[model samples]
Target: MSDLGALFYYLGIEVRQGKEALTLDQSTYASKLLEQSSMAECKPCVTPMEERLKLTKASTAAKIDATLYRSIVGGLRYLVHTRPDIAFAVGYVSRFMEDPRENH
Candidate 1:
């Protein structure tokens, strides 16, 4: 009845078709992003984020590294696009950006 030809590209992602199935991946961009963040040498994990870790509001009296913390969380945000596995962790950390504390 119908045959939709091969897909070339979509939404910044390239499409590759084979006989058996369709596979989705962001390998190229993911590699570049990892390298840019100096995480190339980091250990590879089966999961994108830890389930038990919880981020709480920091304390007011401690000294907070706003720039570094924000940068870390920002990177996480970008990573979330392809790796929604870490979206919760990234979003959790982002909540503290407005008033990051040093102690907590």
Candidate 2:
């Protein structure tokens, strides 16, 4: 293959090359996702989810836009590649994509 150039960014992931080691991150992608979810200014939590918190189908809770929810979930799934810490949360939320509710 032909040499393209120095690796900087690819598929929404940022690449940092150094003499000692290389680093890959999705900070920009994550920030954009936060902006998309309207939580850019939201406070950061120590944990992604509360321990032993159960999530059931919110039959009584108001329903959210399926398209938007799906889009957010999809983005989260993609982000999982660079952020495995959120895989559990993303997978949990993804379960409700078929019919996401406000409580979900």
> What are the per-residue Cα lDDT tens digits for candidate 1 across 4-89?
78886665456678899775556675676677666888998877667786667646567567876677677667657667887876
Instruction: Tell me the alpha-carbon RMSD of every candidate.
Output: 5.0, 1.2
Best by lDDT: 2
The regions of model 2 sitting more than 4 angstroms off are none
Q: How many residue pairs clash in each candidate?
A: 1, 0
lDDT of 2 by residue, 1-104 (tens): 99998999999999999999998999999899999999999998868878887888757789998999999999999999988998999998888999889974
Summing lDDT over every window of 10 consecutive residues in candidate 2, give the lowest-scoring window: 51-60
Give per-model TM-scores. 0.55, 0.93
* Pairs that clash in candidate 1: 59-104
Q: Measured by TM-score, how close is model 2 to the native structure? A: 0.93
Could you tell me how far off, in angstroms, the CA of residue 74 lies in candidate 2 after the best superposition? Answer: 0.8
